[model samples]
Target: MGENLHEIWLKDALVFLFAAGVLVPLMRRVGIPSVLGFLLAGLALGPFGMGALAERWPLLEHLTFADPVAAEPFAELGVLFLLFLLGTELSFEKLWSLRRMVFGAGGLQAMASVIAITAIVALVGAESHAALAIGLALALSSTAIVMQTLTEEKRAAGPVGRAALSVLLFQDMLVAPILILIGFLAQGQEANLFGALLEALVQGGVAVAVILLFGRFVLKDAFRMAARAGGRDFLMGLTLLVIVGGAVFTAAAGLSLALGAFLAGLLLGETEFKHQAEVDLEPFKGLLLGLFFMTVGIGLDLATIWSELGLVVAGLVMLLAVKAIIATVACRAFGVAAGHAIETAFLLAPASEFAFVVVTTATAVNVLDAPTATLVTGIAGLSMLLTPAMAHFGRRLAASVDKRAAGEAVAETFPDLRGHVVIAGFGRVGRTIARILDAEDADIVALERNPVIVARERKAGRKVYLGDASRPEILAQAGVAGASMFIVTVDDAKDAAAMVHAVRRMRSDLPVLARAQDAEHASLLYEAEAEFVIPDAVEAGLQLAGRALAEFGYSNEVLKDRIAVERSVEYQRAAAPPA
Candidate 1:
């Protein structure tokens, strides 16, 4: 009987791994978010679909093996690692730079959502404690799903993306306090509120102190030693040790493990070893995180969902609508323009994985009952499922809003700015270049596909022509024939190469400078007869190397020589005939 059980467990594990391997790539090819794909896979194999697999497969079920209720530690670990990576990507300086958006917009959204939802819950006859818990849970927007979707869409560095990130960062920071509050509410003690608050503060203070002292001072050196040992397994083990140990410590102090993992990430993020840690942990993080999302799918009870379909749908709509309104209002309050405010709101109107963490924690501590927790989790998950569609609609809404505002302006003819640099795709790179050229007193005209960005640029005194660059008619409209240079800085490599080709064909003697995201892209631009092809990654590496050398006491002259030598070698290789 034991042997049969072991065989069943092994088969379940194999089926899960196999399904994930197939579905993720298939989803990518079909232009769906991989998270959605994982969820769909789970649902298909779950009781809702074929139901061939066990209602609760043993091996997969082991992920949620805690006593009181099943707790998927590994799946939770995925959330931890995802947060860690996000924290590592964000530096203190960057956070400080976007303080207004990160704090003002994010803070307003969080507070407003909490208050509004709490009020709604109270109106619906829930107790104050449960209402607060539900409100906090609903306040979160999934950083993992939203960010991943944005990244896949190649908009992770755009205006909407940055705004979404800012709001998510604030939510992450707020999760720590929310976790403590949930713990207090769980105790259900009638002690002084102030005393409970004081206890929470002391516990939080100790956790922070330990993380700062031990994490920064001790863990860095420990990891350095492990890295130097040249044992891959040892380094991997150590990475796990730090994550699990930090989480265990924080959990013991009555805080969320995800918060502890985030803190651990921040600590490592500050060290010289951050990139190495990122590279080493990436595989484990990706696989485990996918598994985590899959478990969320598996844990979803189809029977309950069927029985409460209308309630679930109604709850999902209400939750998303409330979040969107709150976020939109908050963005406006922060002085973001109307169109951008709407986009920002829609992009962040879904409940985050952190919501699940909060809800699960609240339920564990008796702040919420099982059905309520399930309802909240299911709604949150559904919200995440709808995010891609929400984002697409948001962009469309922003576009329509922008067009309505520009009703008269669209008919106005732009001045013929000749002998100036014509920039295609006024995105991050294009806008930056435009700013520099404007500073240098060089006349410039920017062509952007996104009308929202074009409008913003025009409002900022930039002469942006709203059009696609790949088309010859648009290029002609921008005076590309007479321009001194054509700068192709679009995110799409194929588009950049096409623009280069069109420009070269139109005017063989005209110079075209193209920005490529990598070496392969640079080669494509080069083949298109671009006068200059700047590979962003190569330039970034050069800059990093120069900074490192300078920090190590190298003189400017030495650093210049080192850079020149590296460039010369690269140039020679580029100039070499194809093998």
Candidate 2:
């Protein structure tokens, strides 16, 4: 039996590697996210896909997930690792900062989604208790898929991603209580909702407190000891022990293993080993997440979906639409911009991986029947299938909404601002520019999109305003008419070009100096009327070469002449915009 298990494991690993090795890269080359590739691979390889083929063709047995049940443990590990990686990116300070959004936007999003979905299901003839269970189940958006997809898009730190993470954190915390509530709902006349909630709160509190305390006291020392005792192998073993142990301990406390792992990761993030730990766990995380996605696809139950095709389609549509509207409304209520709010809503519209768990728990407790559970599970899987497509549409829609908002915005008043420099993007580059100009006593009005950063800079007595600089209204408010120069230090070259273009349109003679991400971007900025475009790579390379020349005992005059010649003859002429 052990040998058979090992043999099966070997075969499954090969299939997984095949997907990652061949399927994922092929998808990427065609402009598809790897998340979708994993999902599609799972669906095609699972019982509902090629597994169906294997039943007819014995030769195809090796190509499919012949036993998807065996994949669950690895899939669970995938989710835990993914959360742990996410936790490493976050610190407690960041978590505290996100508290308002977590409770305000996230809590409200879940509550509204549950209430709306329950009412709709009840109206559609489901029993009130069952509707409530199902509604709560469907309210959750997939943390794994959402995080994975957004991270792939390189937006994990962007506005929409941060907002989504806040809501996802709240949803993760709610999982334990919701499971308890499902149990209570199942009991019908004998159920004690308050009692269940109290117990859940107590258990959750104890688990969290224990994790926090141990993280503060024991975890670091243990890791330090392990590292000192051996090396990478020891460190990796310790890492696995902590991840798996945390999951076990919390699951024993009646919470999800993924939650425990996430908390463990959150604590570990504060330590010195955070980056190393992330690097060590990432390969495992990717494979496990792929397996988890495949397992979800395996649960699609094609027979049930095919038979109730109309009803299934209706369920999916209602599920995604209801969640999207509720989430969007909740986000808007919390002062999130229309574009970000709508984008977050669409990204989170799908049902979570935990929906199946909820249905299974509810059914086990007799709150819901087998048929209903099957239908909801199928719908949840189907909705997840739409995650990548929804994300693409959401991004385009968000850009449109933001562009419109920027165009319509009434610029904030900055009275008595004249002959100053307008620094468009108050990030690292913008901050440096402001400091240099301030040293020269050059009056400046810095415009930044992130309000938090603006507040921080403003607190430090810098001139910063919260607004997109691409808008003409914003440039005028920043004293563009009287300003000596326009400094477009925004990170994205496209944005820098827009800022340059906006300033040039208002004042054709204003010197537009911009930072470019690359040569191509520099050309674009030049085309947009930037008088001088600094390509980061070019300047960095020159600085490095100058330092190397100095180290090699080259004279200062020679270095200067070579640098000037290279700038004029080699790099700049190649990258320069047309005359």
Candidate 3:
């Protein structure tokens, strides 16, 4: 039995890697989210179809090498890395800057959603404890799925995207306490509730103290030393160690590993190495996240779904509808435009991955039975599958709403255009480029589809247009043809490439400078014949090398030569035809 388990584990890893290699590219070609593909692959190899694998194997089920839990530490590691990355993206300063959105809007959404869902569950005849647990679980949106989709759609830095991220971040921070509350509520006994509550408060206090101390003093020096070591592999390893170590420490203190990871990331985010940390962790983050999603697929029991098909479908629809309506209401209350409010609600209507964690924990604590847990999990999974479709539906709904409110001509025109460089996005990379361009006396005609960003940018005295750049009419109205240079700074490589193609057709000789956020994007831009393809990673590497050389007392000429050699090599590699 041991040997069979080992063999199956190895086979599964290989199959997973192979499938990922194929599925990611195919999904990209089809304009589908890679999450959908990952889930589909799991369904294909899982009990639903081939039945070639089980959800768990004895030797492969450890949290760490020696731990006995069936869920590997890597599964937790995936969540840790995700939270870490999220933290890196958000700093305390930035969080404070957006306090109203982060706390006011985000807090209201969480509170309202939980209350609304709790009521619905109770109305459906669930026990109070079960109803509360379900409501809490449903209140949390999938930060992983929502953020990933927004990123893939090139909307992450947009107003709507930032607003979504802020809400998700608040929800993530809320998860730790919420989990503790569920545990207490599940116990039901007065003594147990009091004891649990006391323990939780103490644990939460300690965790906060540790994070504050680490962030204020220790992490900065530690990362500084690591940065000076100048070894890429070492840096990557150190990053994983911090994430895992933080998670372990948090778990030991009775907190969620995901929360620990997030806190660790938040601390690191305050340091200079934040961007580099994001770069170092990319490969591992992607692979583990993919594996985590695939594992989710593998764990799904098709037999159960087949037996409870109607219940499962009904649960999924009900969850989506309720969440969507609640979210839409919340967004409107926060003053989002009707169209954007609907889009925001739809984008977040699906149940989050965190729901699985909540439901599973509730079941373990006896607040929810196995059947209830399974039902919630299946519904959550189905909601994830429907997320992209819901986003599209919301957009259509928004457009319809807009058309009815104003004439088509008024609705079609993206207002307030002057001297603005018309950046189609405001993502990290896009915003960076925009800042640089803004510094160079260029007025930005920022055209962003995310309503939140559109509002924010408009307030900042920059003209922002709320419309898609790929639409020729949208582009024309943004003065793309007449603009200085059309900058394609969207996160989606395919979309960026398509926009470039469209721009070229419209203005044959226009200079289109694009942000190649990664090697894959750079290659795509090169193929698309973009005038200037800025490989963000390669540029960061060059900057690091230049600074290191200077610190080593190298002459200016020597440093220049070093940079030239690196550039020449990169250019040669970039220009080489794909294998």
TM-score against native, each model: 0.73, 0.90, 0.70
Per residue, candidate 2 scores C-alpha lDDT tens digits across 452-551 of 5766887998777767788787777777888888888877877777888888889999888888876778888888978887888778888899999999
| Model 3 / residue 79 / CA error / Å | 2.3
Q: What is the TM-score of candidate 2?
A: 0.90
The sequence of per-residue lDDT tens digits that candidate 3 reaches over residues 1-579 is 898777656666666776579866697688877877776666665544455333354433221111112435565666678778877877778767767776777888889888988998899899998999999988878776677667667776555676777677677667667888887886556646556657766876697688779779887887778778888776777777888888777776766677678778888888888889998787777777776666666666677887899988887787788878877777777677778778778888887778888998999999999998888888777787777788789879987775444333224444444344657676566678777886788877765655566667668876665666766766777777567677888877888888888777787777778887676777777777678777778888999999999999999999999899998888666645555
After the best TM-score superposition of candidate 2, give how far the Cα of residue 508 lies from its true spot, in angstroms: 4.0
Worst 10 residues of 1 by lDDT: 62-71
Worst 10 residues of 2 by lDDT: 406-415
Write candidate 1's Cα lDDT for 309-386 as tens digits.
Answer: 998888888888999999998887876766777887897988877777788899888889998888888887777767
Tell me the whole-model lDDT of each prediction, alpha carbons only.
0.76, 0.85, 0.74
Pick the winner on lDDT between candidates 1 and 3: 1
Go through the candidates in order and give the clash count of each.
Answer: 4, 0, 12
Which is superior by TM-score, 2 or 3? Answer: 2
Model 3 clash count equals 12
Give the Cα error of residue 385 in candidate 1, in Å.
2.5
Top candidate, metric TM-score: 2
Looking at candidate 1, what is the lDDT of residue 468? 61
